[model samples]
Target chain A: MQIVTNNPLVREKLQDHYAVDYAEGSFGELLVRVRDKAHLGYRLLSHPLSGSVKPNETPYKSVLISDGPGALDVESLTIIENSILTADKFPVKYPQMSAKMRADFQLIDYTLLQSAL
Target chain B: MKLELGYIDIQDIQFSEESKIANGVLYVNKDEIQKIVLGQEHIRSVEIDIARPGESVRITPVKDVIEPRVKVEGPGGIFPGVISKVGTVGSGKTHVLRGSAVVTTGQIVGFQEGIIDMAGPGADYTPFSKLNNLVLKMEPEEGLAQHEHEHALRMAGLKVATYLGELARNVQPDETQEFETYSIPEGMEKLKGLPRVAYVLMLQSQGLMHDTYVYGVDAKRSLPTIINPTEIMDGAILSGNCVSACDKNTTYHHLNNPVVMDLFDKHGKEINFVGVIITNENVYLADKERSSDWTAKLAEWLGLDGVIISQEGFGNPDTDLIMNCKKIESKNIPTVIITDEYAGRDGSSQSLADADALATAVVTGGNANELITLPKLDKVIGDVSYVERIAGGFNGNLKEDGSIVVELQAITGATNEMGFNRLSAR
Candidate 1:
């Protein structure tokens, strides 16, 4: 499986073990990258909106997807597209945080991805 | 299985030299309670406070709310595997501190913790406001990990609640209610002509801060299985979720689940209340598929003619809700899903992330995105600095005058998916 993440912790911990696609942007951007991959027939192995933490709240996210291209999975495309729409519904408001809080968010994101793995 | 819940109505709570329940008043010894909370090394300090109904108090970044309950004559203690030894607990009598609750709050572990206003327009939104809340403000050690921090707070809440529940052990209850569910064969024989119904409870188990425990076992690691509905009354399910406050089922909600209660209200009369099917909302697609498959199989195997599925948190779980609905409906078993919506601020966006035409019968717990202004209260029990960062709060959401403008999502139990709140649309 391939991991798409914007959190540095997720990339750092999983790069050696999996195909980690690191997105250097916001949480929504990471989902967009995963959506783009879904468009290329990479089936989503995890729900894009995995955690209940809203899209605009936490700044980090990590989603798992298939490592290679295959037949276009309509369900994957639909879920990713719907996830993007849902994420957009909540206006992005990435609040500034201390380094410790940032690390906490990163760790939470990494932990969520690990649950799927 | 049969269980009896004896409720000791608590009118108020006060700090005293000794802890006891008498004349509908709960007197607590603060030092003893502090000792229980500080027993864990991860926690550095804890402050105990009380917030009564109709008081001008606000508690924010709240973690979990647990009702104090003691298994008076049961095989096991309250909070089964977590606080007490693992055993069958739903078969006997349990005592409940009816009007009192233990509310846990502290340094925000995640951005999804919620707000509970004792009295205000916001008070009308949360059920916790109506309870005599014993608030615990706990601060963790300097740099505890997020997982450990959550575990510490969860344990503290359960521990304190259990400790307080002990006070009501020998007291006479004001009222007693009994709940029972029969085995599959017995149910079929007893309620010969009635429709068989079951409750599908979707637990929050997405990740570290978002999880639920069943008999002290993490629900995400288990498959969908059948459970005695009465077991829930004895604290079989506990919330370890840091999901958004508006919808996450707190331990209090689990103990007094409206769906279970309402189903029992009509049991044997309108339908045969079969049992509860516990499932988890995991992040992995395969797990979701497997759980939903098992759920459908169990429902068909139980000969359920109808089911009421209650979802915990939103977003990803919506997919599980729909999958369960569709798969179960595919078996010719009708389903009624209970959930809250995030239909945007204007209430124009789609209600759920995933949808299927088969999910036609639904019960909505209002819209979480609908915004409201909470007037500043006189006393704030927990820190309000985390307001702007909480799930439903945006930048500049907390005003200078202490009043906060936020979506209903910020209020605890505002849009509870369990039909626990009064918010709903026709």
Candidate 2:
């Protein structure tokens, strides 16, 4: 049942529905649609969840695929263990700067996805 | 065989007597400076006396002081990592000067920021390491003898300036394909950088040690911009240690010529600077006219800032004897006069003796060693003015007197040996 949800944060959010989703056996693909229009043109793409769900069963996933405009930071993940935390959390230490420049630093986007199993 | 990549780390540190909360991450090479990251923490503060080889990385809190900068020596490539302190108005930039006020050679001072200060007698801090020759201009003052000394001293300064100039060219990095204009601190992204140099010129009147201007250049690319580095003059180019005086060449044989004394102050110490003495021996003598005229013309061409003419002998003896003595004296150059006797061995003296009715005249400006005796228009081998062209195109002439009067301007391969000589001792 734990393998149904791949992301740690997504699994933690799905703890209440685990018993019900496991018995039903109904399944759907977890789909994340992104709308980006920063550049001259608009484009769209589907972000699949990390790792496989089960045979005929959908997997749960959350992916951060976009950042600030003209951003270079991008990554895709494949789930290995459902209950395990797969994302490495490196500390972000910032140096001192004037108060005005501090406002420019902000988290842009993230997502949480769960399929009906 | 594998090429070992050499590493250098520049610590962004400040030494301010007034503050504590230092800011900025001290950039260091991770491979060489493992001690800085031992705790997985960014280095906050530490005092370092000096860095050892391989373990040469240092980290300190960055404050308001100027950061360490880079300097290029001759042919040796770039010598990076130097810091200096900047002073506010009246905070005493002159106080940082090391050694005696009478410096014989140039000296470098490392301060807090990435700035290096160079001070000394006519110091020239250029990128090229191996300097071979130099040209120097002296300040103006009163008196003719002072002017002659100025000429001799200028020769001295030319030698000194050459040494520092060549250091940059000599020590360039092997990896560098062409000359670079910027300072290369470790870890910083390699881009075009700025070259640091210190140039000295003099202006009399506000005192000998008054402030002067310095120009920082890219050395690899453009010429320099002379900026006053003090509050007194701001960043103006035509400030202290420089002044306006007479034109390029004219033997102003008076007691108060401006170009005379300043030149002496510039180059009197180093090198074998020879002095040439000119005397007014013939106001009307037929025999001495030739030598006097040649000497006068030579002086005019050299254009020394100092010249002195006297109207009297040792102890206020005669008032009306000296011609244009006061004019030269007012200029504050050096002066001397031979009022006792009059004689001439050349036709040039006739023109000088007839310049004024005074018994004596003294003037100052450039000096040369080999006394030139311009033969009669028939005895002459070539036009003296053409000496410059003759030097490169044709072999010099053999004077009738058997002495090889080398055309001074034309002598080739005279390798600015004087340039290297100044740096050799330092």
Residue B395, candidate 1: C-alpha displacement in angstroms: 1.2
Ten-residue stretch with the least lDDT total in model 1 chain B:
B105-114
lDDT string for model 2 (A19-111, tens) is 211221111222211222213121111122221111111122332222233442221111111111111110111223233222111000012
Task: Return the clash pairs for model 1, or none.
Answer: none
True contacts kept of each: 0.73, 0.00
True contacts kept of 1: 0.73
lDDT score of residue B416 within candidate 1? 91
Please give, for residues A52-86, the per-residue lDDT of candidate 1 as tens digits.
88888878888898989999999999999999999
Error of 2 at B423 (Å): 24
What's the TM for chain B in candidate 2?
A: 0.19
Q: Candidate 1: which docking quality band?
A: medium
Candidate 1 segments exceeding 4 Å error: B108-112
Q: Each prediction's DockQ?
A: 0.76, 0.00
lDDT of 2 at B122: 11
